[model samples]
Target: MTTSLGATATAASSASAEPGPSTPAPADELGVRAARIRSAELEEQIRTDPRRFRVSTGDRPTGRLHLGHYFGTLHNRVRLQDLGTELFVVIADYQVLTDRDVADDLPGHVEELVLDHLAAGVDPARSTIFTHSAIPALNQLLLPFLSLVSVSELGRNPTVKDEIAHSRQAAVSGLMFTYPAHQAADILFCKANLVPVGQDQLPHLELTRVIARRLNHRYGSGGVPVLPEPEALLSAAPLLLGTDGTKMSKSRGNAIALAASADETARLIRGAKTDSERHISYEPATRPEVSGLVLLTALCLGRDPRQVADDIGGAGAAALKAAATEAVNEYLAPLRARRAMYARDRGHVRQVLREGNERASAIAETTLNEVRAAMKTLY
Candidate 1:
């Protein structure tokens, strides 16, 4: 499902409102609006005379993606791909070690995640999808990145704090503490100029900028900088909640996986919680449960949540639930069928991943080589 130019422009303008982090109001608002206008102009520039401005983003392959993932990140990725940008989609398989107790099934999980991407219409030919573990050079860059960043700085990362709080292990592993550095490596190793990130991840991206600056100061004596400070391409999609009206997550059992069957989707929607007041409305604070349903319907049907609420006027929770269920199921049917076909043809999925890894490694190696040359570590 492609977003229209008008919709993309609107989304870009509203991107400044993403949750978390305080941004400069006037500048952020202006920048977001400018980004929308620039995006159109940039597309024209690329068509007339292509220039290299890469985008790299990823998710940890801990589990299957849900509708929240679709409406939030994946949808935007597809849109960006269509805009003639050099796109790289990483499956951060190594990052999963930060919280997961065991790693025995990681390979299988990564394979499943790749299948999910393909089934969801992520063109393998147009985008490079690789597991983090596959790129040894990229991971090697993490050690140098760690040396560039301070421990005090790492401690201040909110994402790290959140992960440490939720982790079962009392002692935060080196891997967990240095994830920001690894993220820097992921971006720098590809020389990505634009990173599609949510607002909450701004600090991490800021860290990447710091690393790039430090590296350039130390080694950019008479040549091009080895790394580029990637700019954030913020998303404007609303935060999608789970059936329980909480953040949608696999551990919480609130997620409806992208590959879920029709029956499973129906059952999950049927069991979704709603308030005692029979009437449907979009009062998120007062009625999160019903509001969540409204939000879901809006995202699935590409309608405004407020309009959905108005349409359901005197209709009670039952009518709203019925409408939401039908909308979600109808929206997911084709995706579900595609997912099943990919699931059955495991060989095809593997081939896709193998090809993606090769392509990703080729691009990543180019950046790594430049870094080594700049650092005088070519030996």
Candidate 2:
């Protein structure tokens, strides 16, 4: 493997071994670096005692999920679920309103998320999948969690800053600014102890931990903690860049949807930007556009990018594109077909979601009641 691939592999592993056992007392109780160190040690312990850790993750139902979604977190989700871990998958429908106002497409987007979950191997039987707007307590829990963090802190979150810039909005919505707190409610209501996320999201996860710590300290039963500070379980999947060689975005027309037709995958591959040279190699920095295709192939096939490039050695750009296209199509063929099957059974999908909503409401109410009792307001 190349140095880049090796480092990528190492970082991904470390990302999963995150979040320590210490219950932070306040927002400033633990520095980010120290907290991550403790998180790593705590994660190693949780692995041997997996039953103690409840995992949570979510997605905004703005559009269909793509390769990024599958490799980044979905693949590990299926594995964790199969292990009998208590997992909660939230369909963050309310979050989509951060940048959008059109409510007409929201229902379709919610339906698509359910279908995507099934196609991506997230079993409803093992993992509870529910819409964010379904659980009233989930939103109520957000009210108090919001008080634990500050506006400056929210603005400082790397992910939120990126979103603000990407959206290019002069005026940000209150809901958009406070979405991270809403996310805290999502994780803590389930008392999730582990959350599978990308490294880019670590800062936000740290914020969640801080919120849990603050709430428990202020309102716990005689200082006994009411919420769990969840840890981040990072995926090993290397990030895939868009065909444009900058970012994979639907608007840029460089992204490949998980449900894209095999022919469309092929077309995208053929049109992908690459070097003019005939030799195929993995050098993302020097040849990101070309290596981007190689990265896609390597990830889809679960092979090292260098090895993938060697396998396509001297095959020229067209040959390399052909190989990558074939690899992508082969990998997605089954998922797409299964997604289509699930889509056809929308009624069953709705039933799955309805059950999930019911389950989530029951769980959220219990958590909220505990919070209320802790605050002497249960009545």
Candidate 3:
């Protein structure tokens, strides 16, 4: 299934050469260096004065979040929000239609996402949490922004290609092909200056950065740019493989959902694939399955994977599963408690989205007006 959260792209310029399926474009050494420098500078700025940044990050309500979301971005989001950065979390509900024929249980999925966020320690009082469909003004930005990017560029976006290849949609929709443009609209509408992304996603963010620069260069009244060029706030978390030794995903049934009960987490881990070796070791290169379980345990306990592996040495797969289960259950207990509390109050959850949508719409309207004025479209 195509998910907005999992698509990967290389940092190379898609404008020149298109990357083949599973093959990234020729590496752009200069662009890579520039991104690294900018990322480092942004990290320092966030450390000293986080309020100087406005961050835009979100996920599509495809399904319940797994451990991947928790360590990958959700935890960092809470950290950034606590640091006083302006955070806008968009539920890219509309983007779901890009590849899927129908968004089943969309409303339920959205509520679960909010619950997950609240449980994960995202304060709605501090962060603006809204959905794309609720903010018409934000979607409107797509039109003007679409003009700034060429069709070839959109078609060449590695994210689009990856989605199509994985999703295998018989016929791609216009929205599917222009997914990058839509994402650019999502970030630029909020005038966000820092976007948290993985290294594989830099190419997608690069397109958004290009859109911001193009708009500013073409429409800036003075030296001030119309939209801020955003920088990547890369996460330091290691990627967690699925219990089946593949990507952790909801559809695959290998992921342990954040809302899973303690028993469920234990059961899932017990069934996880492991080698026949009587002794456990953290050899990721040769023993990926065993090492993945070790990594999970390490992440949960906040210990080094090697140390965890050493501690588990001579322990069989059963012992490893027991340790991983205990660690994971302990780590997620508090978050799941909060999730249960919020899930009990659906009305309160709905109210959160209502207020966030109103706030997001206001911001988007203001940004849209500026965009129109810059383009001399307003009479």
User: Which candidate wins on TM-score?
Assistant: 3
Per-residue lDDT value at 357 in model 3: 99
Residue-level lDDT of model 2, residues 238-301, one tens digit each, is 7678877877766677888898998888888888888788899887767888878887887777
TM-score of each: 0.89, 0.88, 0.91
Better of 2 and 3 by TM-score: 3
- Candidate maximizing lDDT: 3
User: Candidate 3 lDDT, tens digit per residue, 1-379?
Assistant: 0111222111111223445678754567456556767777887788899988999999988888999888788988988898889999999999887535338678988999999999999999999999999999999999988999999898888888888787756788888788898999889998999999876788899899999999999999779999999988765556788899777888789999999999999999999999989788877667888988988887788776777888888978999999999999999999999999999999999999999999999999999999999999999
The residue pairs in collision within model 3 are: none
Query: What pairs collide in candidate 1?
Result: none
Q: Which stretches of candidate 2 lie over 4 Å from their true place?
A: 1-47, 168-170
Let me know the TM-score candidate 3 reaches against the reference structure: 0.91
Q: Mind sharing the TM-score for model 2? A: 0.88
- The C-alpha RMSD of each candidate to the native structure, in angstroms, is 3.8, 5.4, 6.3
Q: Model 1 TM-score? A: 0.89
Question: How much is the lDDT of residue 99 in candidate 3?
Answer: 37
lDDT, model 3? 0.85
